[model samples]
Target: MSSSRIGLRFFQNSRAAFRNATGPFRRPGAQGFRFQSSDAASAEQQSTFQRLWNSPIGVKTVHFWAPVMKWALVIAGISDLGRPAEKLSLTQNGALTATGIIWTRWCMIITPKNYLLAAVNFFLGCVGVVQVTRIFNYRRSLKDSPVETVKELETEVVDQAKAVASEAEAAVKKSN
Candidate 1:
């Protein structure tokens, strides 16, 4: 016999033994449906792939495909590993980290409890954090030298003054 058949036979025999052992302990008015061996046999005959495909969290459901689709983000993040830290966008990575954390938690509270989605989101958050940390450290290192810090402050002041002057010029032009 095939391994599946052998396993099914063992299961059936154990169930029967359990039912016999518990028969005397049943309440007088208690009623319950029993599975026929044939029904169990037919269910076992169905392939594992078929069973999974028909299941609640199977390929047909959004729970499955959504995680599959979200994997692209993880892949993209991984690909960015070679990218320069200076080129990394803090806001973009921050957004990914926030969404990943939020959705990973949401996955547990939602119906069917999509663990696959949670796993993908968790990895995505990890990738985002790694990139964010790299960017933050790179920016921090740039200001480590006093001269660089002074230059940055000077540039900020100059930029702000330019922006204010431009805004005043625009306001005067509009009033005229």
Candidate 2:
């Protein structure tokens, strides 16, 4: 599994997943190339890039996830301590941090001249991102036990030692 990092491709995939609500569709481009069916085809263009995906599908996704994310942010921020996993506490914090930055940026742009506060919030975003990144260091609970693993290693070592001893004894008898 990956130790998560944000990427443009991830956002693109997320947006596409929301738009299609199935998955990203690969299509043959007219110019003899591969492309995403959503963007490559002009006829099905739900909304332009400038609109920030306000189309029906996108709106539905946002509406569904917005409140959920808000509640999750509260819970994860309050209790989870950014627990890291494929789709657990780490994902929650990651989403929260990303949304915090987006909301802060939106506030900075929409509000009347709050550059100082925006700058502070930008720094807060940096802090949230750094904290969220800590999730990668977290270990899952339901994994193999270290003690059992060590015991298995010990058995293998003992068996190898016995094999080596038997080989040495055979060598000694042959020399005699």
Candidate 3:
């Protein structure tokens, strides 16, 4: 009848639709029950499964390996740094000179490599933590949202359609 009533009815229908859409998650044997269609229902199920699999823990575990590998490489590089420079050449002066040259070259190379590894590890670890937080937040939001039953959604939709039809009829009579 009134605009407010119409708006309220629309919201009620929408809420009902939302509930029907999410109802399967609440109980067993609720599959195939949908306000939309079977295709939409299946899509929802697939997306939910995807979200679960891509959860914070999963993302963190995947991202963790990068830093671990980086650190291992760094440690190996450090062990190489400790080896005798004399092994590079034969005579003492020659060995000293060769070792100096080798050590200097290695030091130069390792400086940048170590920095790069540190930077990569820091970046990846930060990305992993952020992804973990995002997944957790998404899951929390989904859990907090209310789910509706199909029966309630059907009833609400029927009520809304009737209300809209009645409003149209009343408007026609008023115009007449």
Candidate 4:
């Protein structure tokens, strides 16, 4: 009739109920639920997507999403095709190239072997190489033709100065 005795009785009943619900196969100290035949059959009836959702490299994991997000870099590189080669940074492209090559190989070496990651890295490496080549060729051409390079530099400076002046004028007009 004591509070402690009532708690003990409740605990005993709960344990007995759980044991009955779980069936006779489970050990007293067992950690997890043991699936019965019905449970096993239901698991076997799981859809492909449900199976994939629980898989090691499935959508629930970072393994499936990292490469998906990294695709933006590839798209950005492709978009950079329209930009002048002289504007591209040699260091940036070189870093991308190195990262792509290194990760591409590492993807294959890692457990679960993400082929999608490998493909993305390969394309990223190709884009980086192309950009690097363009920058190198542009610099080489500038070095080859000193007079043209000087003219080009002067044109760029003048254009930038004009753009700044126009922006300042617009700001003044807006203030007025």
Candidate 5:
């Protein structure tokens, strides 16, 4: 079977198990009434409910970030890499250090305003770095929290099932 079909089968089995374990908590006669419905109609209703309840909430948010961050990083890295080459060019002597010194002096003489501009750029770059870090961290936390929540929910369901089973067993023993 395809992965999605396998996933659907697993989901259906888990939901059925959950329902069976929590049967006593449901309204009296609800199960009997539900089972009397036409099979196709019931299946359709169950599928609709599953789609509504089980859809992941963060997928759209992740999709929005994926391309945005990818392009942002690519552009940022390319532009940053070009900065040094643009500012410093090789001299006729082919001395890299001398060329860099010449470029520094040239920048100071030709664009005194560049000092302020550089400061502003540096500040903005720092802000961008922090923002990107926070977004990455937020995504990681979002990924982790849901898994933890699902595990906790499953544990609670199992515990409730065990409690119900024990109660039922005790009641049966008493009746006998």
Candidate 6:
């Protein structure tokens, strides 16, 4: 037999194996319905997630939250950059934690047999906590560090005072 024929035979056998494992859809009463493509306008109403996800506010929120969540994922190290959707900021992390808690509760309620998902939810919440603390610690250390200037401490202090005075003067004029 030719190489191409052999390859085709292999493909046919694999297809047969797949079909045998699970019966084709729309076969009969026990079988599932056949898949069909449908336009959005003519089809069933969109899912809650799909509706919100395509909206302007949803787009903006995902874009903004992605960066913050990315940073947190970086700190976690074990997490994948592409996983969990976005880099949520500290505030967004709170939302994420709440989501995890809700999912855990849902899994517990829906199926006690599937405790694995609940465990995953618990881990998700922990990651959010760690991410928030890491962000805070990093920011606090960055703020306290004296790496910005070559000038002495006193010169830096004097310069800041002048800047504050000028800002105050501007504010006073603005109020007039």
**1 or 4, greater by lDDT:** 4
Residue 152 lDDT in model 3? 43
Query: Could you say which candidate leads in lDDT?
Result: 4
Cα lDDT tens digits, model 2, 1-176, are 35354576688788766554432443433221122233535645546652435333233344334444455445445454444334444444555577668766775565244444445445545556766555333331333575664455457557767998999999999999
User: Which lDDT value does model 6 have at 153?
Assistant: 32
Off by over 4 Å in 4: 1-44, 145-176
lDDT of 3 by residue, 51-105 (tens): 4454432333433354456555334433433444323211222222333334434
- lDDT per residue for candidate 1 within 17-104, as digits (tens), equals 7565545665443333232222456558879886677567878889899999999999999999899998877667877998899999
Q: Please, what are the lDDT tens digits per residue for candidate 6 over residues 1-176? A: 89999999999998766544544543333221122223446225777666556443343454334434544433553353234333435555555567667766876686223355566666676776666555455444555554432234346447767998999999999999
Clashes per candidate (backbone, < 3 Å): 0, 0, 1, 0, 0, 6
Candidate RMSDs in Å, in order, are 18.2, 19.3, 31.8, 13.7, 28.4, 21.1
User: What Cα-based lDDT does every candidate model obtain?
Assistant: 0.80, 0.51, 0.46, 0.81, 0.46, 0.54
**Higher TM-score: candidate 1 or 6?**
1
Per-model TM values vs. the true structure: 0.59, 0.27, 0.20, 0.59, 0.20, 0.31
Between prediction 1 and prediction 3, the one with superior lDDT is 1
- Candidate 4 to truth, TM: 0.59
Better of 2 and 6 by TM-score: 6
Query: What clash count does candidate 4 reach?
Result: 0
Q: How many backbone clashes does candidate 3 have?
A: 1
Q: What ranges in model 2 sit over 4 Å off? A: 1-88, 115-120, 139-176
Better of 2 and 4 by lDDT: 4
lDDT of 4 at 3: 100
Query: What lDDT would candidate 3 get against the real structure?
Result: 0.46
| Positional deviation of residue 113's Cα in model 6 after best superposition, in angstroms | 4.5
